[model samples]
Target: MTRTTGYEPLFTLKPVAPEIWVVDGPILKFYGLPFPTRMVVVRLTDGGLWLHSPIQMDDGLLQALAALGPVQHLMAPNWIHYAFVPDWQRAFPKAQTWAAPGVQERAGSRGLALRVDHQITDHAPDAWAGQVDQLVVPGSPVHREAVFFHRASKTLILTDLIENFEAANLPVWLIPLAWAAGTLDPDGKAPIDMRQTFRKGREAARGAIETMLSWEPERLIMAHGRWYETGAMAELNRAFRWVLR
Candidate 1:
């Protein structure tokens, strides 16, 4: 049930670049399925912190993040990824909360009075425009995930788009399920269900991939499982081949 985060020293920042870091958090069970959590922290050019899909936070984690910089933006990268945004907002009341499409509706469905300050588009907002780029992958109504690429670090950030669950980290029973869902490491891609959403018109997904490749990413960060430390372009192509084809 544990090890979903996969990285060590849970809830602590792991430096990826001078301006970028990752925090692997505790496992969260979704509909009886145990899923590890992760978040991307980016320090904008002006020194404000942009949190992408923030994980659960505690006092120690808050103090550690405070040391990084001012938490200016709390981003809900996708609809379901906003669970802990309220916690972060409560801590840093001044931080602006941005959400991807459908997040507000998802929150309402769950009876959560989530505050969404702005809706993300395919382009980065002026807040971090030159620092980060965003793309809204089309062809799916339900899985309208807006992905990001950090220009300074050449790090591409994805949510459930590509889940690479390591066998060693997954539970004994989850190993097969991960494999069946095409989320196992070394050959991971978008889950079968998500891929299906783009089946009707994958050209949009392929276009998104083309744009991502144009960024010449050096590494990749995913919310679940192991993220790539290098060869991000190849992995990006390999992981989204189902939709690209």
Candidate 2:
């Protein structure tokens, strides 16, 4: 079965901080392996929402999000993470969609009808510039993710960089696969193959890691599995030690 177990009570917003919430969504198969999905919701200072790596849109989710604020921005944090963005853009028709470097090309290569309203850069855009800080992490061409840090919440938002899948939640056979991929909980970093892609881009990857570490984030959120609720400095150092050190 390609359907994997996920955090239950999916597609509902759960509080993360004062203005930050997370929506845990259904499992999606990646190359025949099921992986749980998650997305971050930040109600900006203007009451508009900035969704990071948006999950599936359902009626209840749409209505609940509408109550929060207008979905102003739909984020494609990384190339591989933009699958559901097309649906989200249809739901929030006026919402501006942002992509990381190479995400547009990646989407096109996949034959996904996606739109790119803006591309993330070293500086955050006027829409979310003051409230949130963004950086396009340089490393693997396919994994060049636009990572965000919400200054108000001191939360670091990431997608695919660190996937911490719990052993018990996965199928017994998948546990070994997780270990081989280096996604086992408590030690999750990028998957083993993704790490190889950073070899040629080591300096660039280190620069990105250094920037993320400099943020001194308190909470680290990732799309897959359990995220670090505290001690982000240590976690950042530990997770990126392979490339950074």
Candidate 3:
């Protein structure tokens, strides 16, 4: 983890795979849970940039992103991850913002005005012409929870679906929950919360997992936990066994 000091809240940039970076900020403690939040950056073939679940933008981070390339697309893969879109849009006015289906409606309920250039659907892969692959992980009240795979880097990007936090970092009360949920590394298994989340739409979630597994990605980049560098598909299978069960 490359740490950035002198910032009010420190942010770390870690490269999960080639041309794929995971930017992690301070721990967000809410709902009696402390989880590391992250954002992903992918460099596209056309010299354009695609950001997945952008973290809170500061002048430093914004300048760092601008130096990389012109951001052409900003994606909010799930409704819960929409908090930073407005700030990102304001920073990169030229970029086209995208939200998953029903995101705008959900955002409105939260008193947020999300101006999306496009709403993501199953056909989005075809629309982007294989530039990115998106799979909707069905479950949880939070709709539009799509997992993304960037073709250029063969990196599967996820948010909230599979978390792999180290046990030492968690509070004592949370440790048991993390252990029960299979979130504790190195053999981090999918937690009970994730299973419960999947129970609501087992069929749809299974289908989405099956579709994503077919990609045979070598690396898995996650938003709230440690990324998998090798045998990513196998890890994914192990984490989401509730679908198979």
Candidate 4:
């Protein structure tokens, strides 16, 4: 399918692959500076929507998504990406909320009551099996990220594992920190904190990274920045190269 339109609307709803739509949300103050967020909506073979790393869901956005398919699954891809989960759950009452390991605990810690219907494991659930593959990326004790592979689209969906921020879209003061995090655009890499996470549990992290690499994904969808179209696998390998080495 066609990649982005080179421009992201207020809630950019664009198709990155078959049965997958990404919505770029508003800029929020992150680390005391403006930062953007994104979410992916996947229409399963059964015509149910699986939300990955959800963003702020407004009436307009909800209407747009409903037109595509019934919201069936709201997924918290990682501990750090569950902020807007309660909002989505309220919108789609019938949808089953899936939590990545440690997500429920983390949400509770923040006093944000979460509705986790099921916990996502390394194996793909019955609702999405054969169509989508999943793996729980280990090593980050602070954030356990559940990565997904859409078999029909050969696309890998990641949350915060790799962050790419365009310097022009950020405040001048945030640029240096972004660069230090290895998240600056055109040279997107794993965030510094995540790299340290891997260092703590390198062996386990390596196993998880190898599982992701084995998928040989053709495209990638990220939560904080632009997704990768071509050479997705290469970009992925590069992002976690330190651990890979």
TM-score, one value per model: 0.97, 0.96, 0.85, 0.93
Model 3 segments beyond 4 Å from truth?
A: 1-13, 125-128, 139-143, 187-191
Query: Order the candidates by TM-score, highest first — what do you get?
Result: 1, 2, 4, 3
The candidate with the higher lDDT, 3 or 4, is 4
Candidate 4: tens digits of C-alpha lDDT, residues 34-115: 5577888899989999989888777888788878889999989888888888987887789999989999998899899998
lDDT-better candidate, 2 vs 3: 2
Q: Please provide, for model 1 over 111-197, each residue's C-alpha lDDT reduced to its tens digit, 9 standing for 90 to 100.
A: 888899999888788899888999888888788888999988899999999999999988799899999999999899888988888
User: Candidate 3, residues 79-193: lDDT per residue as tens digits?
Assistant: 7678889888887888888887778888899899778998776656433567778867765554447788877677788876777887666667877877777788775655566
Tell me the tens digit of each residue's lDDT in model 2 across 1-245.
44545677888899988999998998888899888999999998899999999997789999999899899998998878899999988877899999888888988998998999998887998888888998887867657888899999899999988888999789899999999999898898899988888888889989988888888899999999988878888988888889877
lDDT, residue 134, model 1: 94
Collision pairs in model 2: none
Among residues 3 or more apart in sequence or in different chains, the pairs in candidate 1 whose N, CA or C atoms overlap within 3 Å are none
TM-score for candidate 4, please give it. Answer: 0.93
RMSD of 1: 1.3
lDDT of 2 at 125: 86
**lDDT (CA) for every model shown?**
0.88, 0.88, 0.74, 0.84
